[model samples]
Target: MLIGAGYFFELLCTGQLKPVAGQPIFQETRFGWVVSGPADNVINSGGWAASAVNLSITENTETDLEQSITTFWKLEEYESKSVYTKEEKECESHFDNNINRDESGRFRVRLPFKKNDYKRDTQLKQDYIKCMSEYEALEHMERVDNEIENKDREGKYYIPHHAVRNDSSTTTKLRVVFDALIAEDRRDFQHVLWRPEPTQPIHVYRLNTLTYGTVPASYLATACLENLANTECDSCPEVGELIIRDFYMDDYLGGAMSKAGAIQLRDDLISIMSKAGLELRKWLSNDPELIVNVHSDNNNIRGRGQCPDSQAKILSEIATIFDPLGLFGPVIIIAKIIMQKLWQIKVNWDDVLPDNICAEWQRYRDGLPSLNNLRIPRKIISNKIVVITEIHGFVDASEKAYGACLYLRTTGVHKNIDVKLICAKSNVAPLKIVSLPRLELCAALLLSRLRNKLIPKLNLKINRRRFWTDSKVVLAWITSPSGRWKTFVAHRVCEIQELAACSEWSHVPTHDNAADV
Candidate 1:
């Protein structure tokens, strides 16, 4: 017998039953006919029973395929927050108020602690003692005994420290790092180190310079650099500007076009940093003669053996290629497409890929070694004197991907023209089917952004800037009023116009557009 409830049972029962003697009955229901009753042949065994089984299976095929594509292309959307937080503003204010220069010309800054009542934990105190003991031994710290603690002032704060050991380090294997994040406020910039032995007196040492690993350490250091630049801007403006722009934390990555210019920049850097008790070291350059006097060492580390054939391994190989400027965008786009396919198929991290994908990955992996044979010139512009300088950016798009390429076009005093590719960027198309014109517009927007970024960082003077595209539709949309079109095209056109003027955009034949490659 079949059992159900509500409308289902009513519908099943609201049918005529056609019965025949010595045969099963057939009932006509809303969902057509249903067979009922028993088998024709019965076993002659006693206490026998029959049963039936039914399964209603359902499957969901919906997937956000665009998410996988966006992830593979690293096209992340970031919400812009307030530029400065309350803590950051407080840190900046503290630096501005307490910062000073000693008679020796070295800048001095106080630690910006958030709270005054914080006390060091027992384990932290022990670590601080050990770190201070080593500091005293190295003569980097001195013991103080004359000054007594003033009850009117805030309580003393202790910064905890720990050692970080590097087995591959050649000079210092163990480095003691102070935890500035956990530091508290205090009137006196002193740390007390108690010796385990009762006979030895407690030692108090004042920290003079900016403490590393502190919450305000980076801000203080950066502020000091900026102050130094401002102080020396009247005399060495270029060096000052370089200090503000080129210095990433403590490392400087600036360069000059000519040898004499480089030597001057190096000297100015040394002089400016010396005024603030900072020294530039480990100087390295492509021109060996520039740093010939600096000692250098070579250490070769072997790479791990070939990775196993798996989805995870393919991703690992893809990440190993470091093309910061997207110079290899064309080649890398292929790998990105493969990754998108893997994501679409919902392959587990370590699961084996489909045969077709695996074969494609292996071919791409094997061809990567051939990339070493390709060499690109470091300098985009020629050494000869150039009378005219221009930046040309080309944008193109296909069904699979869209990209933009920027080239430096220079004309020498002799009217000799030279064009070299400076930078290029590409992104995989969204999985959602989009019109080709829309992708071309995206390529144009990418080109405009690329130009805006490249032009500012370039030290060379650009006489003119031009943007090229193979799509006439994109050109018309850019030249016309942005409000005339739909939201998608209009928004991109507005941004493109803001970055580059409508006149700067022009149409190029697909055959001539370098980005088409």
Candidate 2:
């Protein structure tokens, strides 16, 4: 017996919600009533005779049924905490094993052969509200106070939304391209909860304001702009694609190969996103001419582009380097390793680090400033022509962590072999640690993942793809057929074999493996 708090909140905004039997409901309602067998779902804001439910729905004049362009959530009247309804407060919170009961011992179901004609229309409207409420519930769970702000891992000049863009995408279609869900910081399915401010009472939202720095917010915002780009400006297909693909969350972490192409893309991206009511800001370009044309000097942008002051300082990380591509893999791994050691000792967020941990963390932070000098040229050889190219991957593991890296070795016009590190990944050994060989197998798997991603990301043609690993056992595991190893090694090896062939793997001395470093 539950009605969405969001729908009710919407009506409250337009002054349409009224107390019905002491239950808040709009004069015109979506879910007419889905109360219990002999009882109603809602009673009052006070203690209910049975279960209590309320919905905030707005009565709009033009009536397209109704929906919110801004917010995706509204909580149960004031369910700050979850306690069983008095009816079944003692034992367990479930109607029966057959029914889908939530932790709060509340649920609703469609009754078969319930109605036709007038009743059918009511049923359809209920379905709409139920579907919308469920979807909004999912979206709300995604954007609560929990947040993950990615530091400016790649030291680029102009980054949008700066530190917050690191939260990975949550869109259904594009979730696989970036990272995936790890362990969440808070409890799961935080349905129908929105607290705009901590000091004020917990009120439902009218605008879709998830956590400001959370992944769902950044992903949904960009996805909104991208969808708008497609539907609004179908004539400009290139602009639409760039809007969707080139962005990492809100930041445009992409570029074109030539000046004409870059300028055209830049202009189209800005114009398209702007049309969707999304403003592009902190526009940084290697081309000095391009930068001047796009950069805005005016400080006040009404929350459109750059937030007045963060115009120039977009190229550095605040705490951690989120180099998804392992350019700084080794150094970043070391920092994480130190953090792990500290965590092992059970230090809280505010606790001061021990001297050893503090020193290492400080060194890493200090070294980050030097990344400003380490420049990777934007032009993939604006001067030379490459006759041949090779993609090499290196993998290694220690007790603390395992890592992998990808390097492009190109034989250019002079037959010179120039090697450049593209991207890498470093994962800390699992808590219930496996053997070194298993960890090495994990590193190899990471290398394979990096290879699959790096190949598509790079705009180059390669003659060969190769992988190197320091561990002989991991190499044997890869070289052997899929089912030869035990469960742990077998699973990783299976993935590696699928992504990278046995012929592609080679054994290198521990010191020589770049990933080992």
Candidate 3:
């Protein structure tokens, strides 16, 4: 029986179990290998007896018996080893004290949730809190409506009678609700107006000029719009878009006012407020904690019916409502994209260093008078001043190449105090540096540098120090009245004008200027 059982086990292992109902075994080696009934064989006690076993060639000949043995053994006695994670353990520990609690010594199932577990419930609880807040605000609004209705019932329509209205309690409550909502959104009213860029970190709030102040209210609204969905006030559009829309609507209603006009009005209002010694705009722009003027237009006939200034102020306030951190990610990202696109366009090298002056420089350096014999020596010129320009075509595009500028000055109109302007390029190009044109600029920078660096060393006390450039355009720009040169080259012209503020700037019409050497 053991032999037969072993034989049967071998057949199962090799997967060769096949039998004809009444057939005898064909044994080649005369070893006992016979099929038996369940009644006779102890191994077949679990109903392996007399069963029709079928066998067919199912797989390829190169199957691994060792791997099959390992798989069968693993299936028979192996138990899956489960690893409990830290979260699972923590959950189990939490469940031990809360979920699986013993009540009256009986395993009482906890129904669902406790009062303190409102946060655990995702839907109903959050909705309930939001609804409650809205209801409170609505109730406050309704109370204001009720007070107005009572006033109407009393027939108080006259100016004096209407003047004695009292809705402070309701108004205060409404403000509280709005403030709470603002807080929830991580937007603080005061913060929006004062936040700076995260990377540059320049404090915009501190830069207050007579013309403009630290972050405008519209800027704050821009921040809110940028962080709309992520903020507590997700439902509301940014204050700027709404304000602009409202402004357009007002324009539709026979009111023709532009942002520029509003700005002008603000200035006028500031002037008016200053007369009363209550310069609110300046203070508001400068001091973060300064209380804005709420009652400035209360009695003034000029501040009649719809106070535009007050509306603007209010809108500005709303716009600056910022999240605690200042500007959001999306706004910065959009701003960066804009900046990148701007960077893509080729740089204006001519603007950096113009070619006309550069051509003149080449002429000046080639034994010309402009570089050496100007009304003032190059050495005494301010190092900040431009002396000569170098114009060279770029390898990629000749029309839009570099225009290297050089500034030179003498220390005190002395020969030793000479300064030179060198190429602004990374590597020094000798030919470009010492070339006829470049030398003139180099001479200018050298002179300017020398004047600045060596004048103190020389201890020269000249009452009227001057520097000269032969460009008539530059000279005109420097000497022209601010009102006359307002177009075409205002920025550049202003720069030249500023240079003339300290030193005597006069035209040296190409012939006498030594830089033209």
Clashing residue pairs in candidate 1, if any? Answer: 180-214
Best by TM-score: 1
- Tens-place lDDT digits, model 3, residues 364-473: 22322231232222132343423332111110001111111223333433333444442121111232223333322322233333344333433334444455555444
Candidate 2's TM-score reads: 0.52
TM per candidate: 0.64, 0.52, 0.19
lDDT of 2 by residue, 1-517 (tens): 4547766655333334444455434443344432222245645677656543444344435322112201111111211236655533321222122223235322221111212333556644554455546657888424433323655446534221101122355632111122343311222322345677888687543422234444333433544555565565678876677667677777777777788888887777777666545567777665567767665433221212221122011111222244544566666666556545655777544455566655555565566656655665655433467888889989888888887778878887887777877777776786786788888887888778767755876757778998998888888889998787778888888888888779999989877877766
Model 3, which residues run further than 4 Å from truth? Answer: 1-135, 139-417, 420-470, 490-495, 506-517
Candidate 3 C-alpha error for residue 137, in Å: 2.1
Provide the overall lDDT of each model, using Cα atoms, as 2-decimal numbers: 0.77, 0.58, 0.32
**In candidate 2, what residue range of length 10 has the lowest lDDT sum?**
69-78
Q: Of models 2 and 3, which has the larger TM-score?
A: 2
Instruction: For model 3, give the 10-residue run with minimal summed lDDT.
Output: 391-400
Instruction: Write model 1 residue lDDT over 337-356, tens digit each, in one string.
Output: 88778779987677877888
lDDT of 1 at 495: 90
From the highest TM-score down, the ranking of the candidates is 1, 2, 3
